[model samples]
Target: MLFRNVISILLIFGTPSLVLGCGFPPDLWCSSPEISEKCGVEKQCSLWHSKQALTDVPLVRYELYYESLCPGCKQLILTQLYPAWLKVQSIVNVTLVPYGNAQENKYGGKWNFTCQHGPAECVGNLVETCILSILPFDKAFPFIHCLETYNPSTDGKYCASLYNLLSYWPSIEECSTGPNGNSLEHDMAVKTNALNPPHQYVPWVVLNGVHNEEIQSQAESDSLALICNAYQGVKPAGCTKTGFIRSPVKKIL
Candidate 1:
């Protein structure tokens, strides 16, 4: 009986089913990167290279905390922010921190808070960091898109997809199963639970390893343009201050 109980517990907690199958169409996977040479042309491909350059550099570094099963995280990446970054070819290295199952406790209890809807934002960070370490952004982008499509309501499906996507090539399954996997999630859970209390939220983006006034103020659109211009060495001309407000967390930092 004890052995059976242990097995049940392991099955319950060892792996959470957050990832489903790939959300993006198959054609996206086959598209060639060569097609997108310049910014504003085939923006997604350009951004992939830009992100690659940023991550490839030794000095520049940034961390993005996300929950793997969070829908808001998906909207933030696919609908709002990443597209812009792709257009500019922004060379910013990002770290992904996964906070699993933001909506419920390990015992399967629900907690109410600001962004507790899903785990996509926090987990997205983990996937990003894992991809950065192993595969280039070009190959990593599709894998990330696949992971983001996961629906937490289903359980483990998203995680399974993530496992499959990285199993080939550089193989990120090791990282997913390593200390960083749980560590990042634990850190994010502690921080978010403290901030909102009784509820867990994800997609906490920290720039330059500090979530201070400088990064927070600069994140604002009117303000972000200035920061972007300074960092990218370009004027903020024609850069509209719209669509950066997907999450209230971005406003904080």
Candidate 2:
């Protein structure tokens, strides 16, 4: 009976749904050169923030704690975040946290929660977390960028195939929408729920644990510039050419 009950929580479908988001903090994230890249060069499958970061190097940690289906979240990912990745994939590491402002009510191994955008957002977050679990960012981010294009509410499965990630969709879906999926989200909640100052809204954008109000304000138009500015390493040529150093981003407490 205990085993069966545990299974129920792990596999239980969403009985209800919720929403969640961003906030301020400090050092915000530490760097440990002792730890290697978040994922190794060989390309092991793991969560986005899996590895320990090297603080000594010039690195800008862009962590987006967001809900899946939020309109603003969708816009920023496609415009600012995606383009930023293309330009600075070598210099920056972006962490996508799907447990926006939502609360997770744990039942055994199963997690029941609600999202602001409704059930779809909750479902979408699970799907995204599952993808990151198995695929590295280079392969996974493209599919995610495309999935949001057609509206995740209805075309999540189709987008997977469209982006050529179809081969992995079966496993992805099984883990995302099932007990396995629940387990992943539960872990993510543990991380997101512990944000230092707590989030005020979705797309709670942070750079190295520092929430920059200025960058968040102009994320779409100036994200790359902001990241480039935060970069402490040797500046890229593009940074000089643009002549656009974003205004200092303010970190909230």
Candidate 3:
């Protein structure tokens, strides 16, 4: 399926509402107490988190359901998602689901997966899943972007090293190669399958827990604008109305 050619299928919430933390999603990058305590001052996360919290502004939800090795998925991640995230991360609750177009079956008392790209892609998915599970969103996302930037099909130790995350690689390796990874991928599968209208392609973008043609097109073309427009509270500097129009994101490939 083409990346920009989105199928407008609406999906229902398949899981219970996860508890929000620090006025946003628990997995939100820098708003939680633990994250704030650890790196808030260093990262200057307070400027964004405190602003949103004080204003009682609800964060715009942005979710991407994609596979590891899909070219279009990589394009969106590298060009659109990552760049837009850096600009609007504070006002957006971003969720990355890596298992896409993959089927699961129980055989020999174990779960087996068939990925869209190949076995390598399944491994890539596990690596990403392990990364997301091991680190908070703030740390996990950069590593993921690095992985996609270089090569998603290989072991992600290089990306981990880039982020001083080698200390956590052993745990990530263990989880990815064992039952932990399987369970995580299964949860992803459940979420992907639960789409009310069922996703028709990878790089499926959902806005505010709902998916449609207009939102998907807007997200793929310029996710920053999409998030900024969807936001209901104070606009971030990038999305300010002081004659600062965000340039349209150019497709990398």
Best by lDDT: 3
- The TM-score of predicted model 1 comes to 0.42
lDDT per residue for candidate 1 within 1-253, as digits (tens), equals 3234333443554422221233333234214543222111244444444544455454324444555555555655564445545543344454444453453234333222233443444344444445555666655655565556654323224554555652542345455446554454455556544542222333444565555545433343222343354354332233544335533333211
> Lowest-scoring 10 consecutive residues by lDDT in candidate 1?
15-24
On residues 1-253, what C-alpha lDDT tens digit does candidate 2 reach at each position? 3234322332343211110111111111112222212212112111112321222465678888877877777777877788777777777888888878777787875789788778888888888888888788998888788777876556767887887777888888888878888888888898888887677777778888776566567554577787777877665555554332343333222
Highest TM-score: give the candidate number.
3
Q: How high is each candidate's TM-score? A: 0.42, 0.70, 0.74
- Model 3, CA-based lDDT: 0.75
Q: What's the TM for model 2?
A: 0.70
Cα displacement (angstroms), candidate 2, residue 3, comes to: 62
Off by over 4 Å in 1: 1-62, 100-132, 150-170, 173-201, 212-227, 230-232, 235-253
> What's the true lDDT of residue 228 in model 1?
51
Q: Evaluate all candidate structures by whole-model CA lDDT and list the values in order.
A: 0.44, 0.67, 0.75
